[model samples]
Target: MDVSIIETSSLGDRSYLISAGAVGVVVDPQRDIDRVLALARDRGVRITHVLETHIHNDYVTGGLELARTVGAEYVVPAGDDVGYQRRAVGDGDLIDASPILLQVMHTPGHTHHHVSYVLRESNGGIRGVFTGGSMLFGTTGRTDLLGKEHTEELTHAQYHSVRRLAVELPADTKVYPTHGFGSFCAATPASGDSSTVGEQRTTNPALTQDEQSYVDELIAGLSEYPAYYAHMGVINTRGPAPVDLSLPAPVDPDELRRRIEDGEWVVDLRERTAFAAGHLGGTLGFELSDSFVTYLGWLYQWGAPLTLIGENEDQVADARRELVRIGIDDLAGAAVGEIHTLVAGTELRSYRVADFAALSEALREKDTTVLDVRQRNEYAESHIDGAINIPLHELADHLGTLPDGEIWVHCASGYRASIAASMIDRPGRTTVLINDDYDNANDTDITSAT
Candidate 1:
């Protein structure tokens, strides 16, 4: 069996293409279907089936559309109420794709309708398991995505679901999970991406702890996720629109200014250093990278018209791809060129990028309020003494509560702090960004509140 792992780095999500003989199956595909289709073409195999572990709550799935494009069967969980035609698969059902045999196993933990597909060899020997959002490298999927009420119940179910895989499958059976690779869906940060059933039995926290202890630990470790996640579940249930990879229409300076005046978001997708040096007034600085989707989706208003500001067309295209994954398709336009030309004499906003030593000096010299924009769990683990914890997601709402003085913003790295700095920095408000590595926090004379 030839198995290919297609990783979407921005979301840390993985999709698999398993081929046997002349036929193949795609599992947990992203909205962009061309990549998966290209894999099949490269392998000289026809796509026979497109499988979804569940209605994904992170990014839009390309399963239904990919199935239609290739004339393949779209398979989903039996209990999912996805409003579209699909081959509803149930537990203990067997599917044949020529040389690869898939057995469906119901693992209701991440979601009540979640399932794991186990691959068997020609002689019915267990080969590998696609454990989407159920069993990850060192941890399991976060149970709180559904809601606070369902957290404990799902965590309890997750314990048994992981055990079921361990007891039923061979120790050498490989495990491929959809979440855990830098995704917020993971209960804890994974050690790596791929692990075997035997390795998980010994190393996975979910399998090592008792049921209640596991539930408690999982719940306690949960932190704030992207607000855009709320729209994903509903979008998946109702069927997402087909993805359009066409570049957004380019807007000139006047047009961009008009949209901004009309209350549309003008997001600048540049590095934090470039953004901090100089940027258009009121423009949000979100660096185009892996965490781009997560933080942009979290802070951006849903359904609001948006205009992207980037260094060039390619940067704008990259930013667009990331946004489209989370269903933020209301891209009004894009502005690409030199920053000065885009702004055109408008007073550029700038913030001071400080190192740990500079931050300590600033704190001592003035009444500077150190604002840590990391997640709650991160803040709870360790933070600078007397630092105010307002996660980046909640910053917009808590702006009024900021202390009346110089605000020093920071995250583990400067990515999130740059975002916060742009949002909070205005004419009168002086915001200094601690843009250095937070690991160097221990090197400073500042006390850490552990």
Candidate 2:
């Protein structure tokens, strides 16, 4: 029997393949089927079992596609609501594969329905456990994602779930968690791609915290979530399965422009701050700082031809990679040259911002509209009076509500304001950037973007 850990960092995901007796099992594979396929083909092994620890939210999984290609059994928890073929395995259920044994563990916290699998070598009897998002090396699941009604109950449940794994599972059991460093799944890693149960018991910080404090801290620290979380679970539960991934041809700017003019939805893949500044009128804006790839799949329709306006040419490839992860394949290419030319025919104008004193004077004169694009905490901490707060993270959805007047955007620094200023696309709406960290300047303008 042989075990291999596939580091699928491209999608910012990690999965494992266990092979024995001519049959291999793949756990939580990423959207790139070719990588998984190539690895199996090279090893002269065929995938016969596809195990999804849970319905993932961070990125789409290639589990179903890989299963279809290999004629494997796709398995998930009965509680797992997903759109593809899957056999539900509950706690204590086991699958035998000559030299490998897998036992299912129900660990719900990251989502209402999630699972982990404990695997063992037939000869040694027990070797390791595959913990999906529910349990990472040293951290535990964040209970805030569950609906507000279940928040308290789930938080307590998560505490017990961690307790169960830490107390009941064998100390010698090697741990293979779903994600590692840089993944949103877990912040702290005790050691290695794997850990021993005993080691985690003594070292994992999550386990050391008393149940209540652990829950509060974890929930409180969660960043402003992606703009698309609520609809994702439902979509994954019943939406049409993701289409096959075949990289789209690179589109020329002229072709992209034609598509834009032809009524296809154009996406501005810069950060919210950038998009709010000034961009092609009517383009859907999502900043690269947020979860652009995941929300790209959620907010936009699939099969929709996508034209992009990014910070640079290099980001075009990065944007494409993320869109492809969830099977969104249509491309109309990127915005080239000064974006102003594209909006020249439209009324979307650009405005700039200066220091609070300058902004105050402008407010008195009523020359421009001020947009505060900082977090709620930052906005409450200290901000310019009379400035309307529409956090940069929520800019995409809330932009429609703002008055389409001369729009001046500002964040903590000039960098964010420059990005925020780009979202103004109406011919009449002039967008401007404010150097919020200004040491001397009183105001800044959209032209400040370089």
Clash count per candidate: 0, 41
Instruction: Give per-residue CA lDDT, model 1, range 157-229, as digits (tens).
Output: 8999999999999999999899889888888888875789999999887788888889888888787788888
Per-residue lDDT tens digits for candidate 2, residues 40-105, read 877777888888887776666778778887888888888765556688898888876555679888
**Backbone clash pairs in model 1 (N, Cα, C under 3 Å; residues 3+ apart or in different chains), count:** 0
Best model per TM-score:
1
Q: What lDDT is obtained when candidate 2 is compared to the true structure?
A: 0.66
Error of 2 at 310 (Å): 8.1
Specify the highest-lDDT model's number: 1
How does each model score on lDDT? Answer: 0.88, 0.66
Poorest 10 consecutive residues by lDDT, candidate 2: 441-450
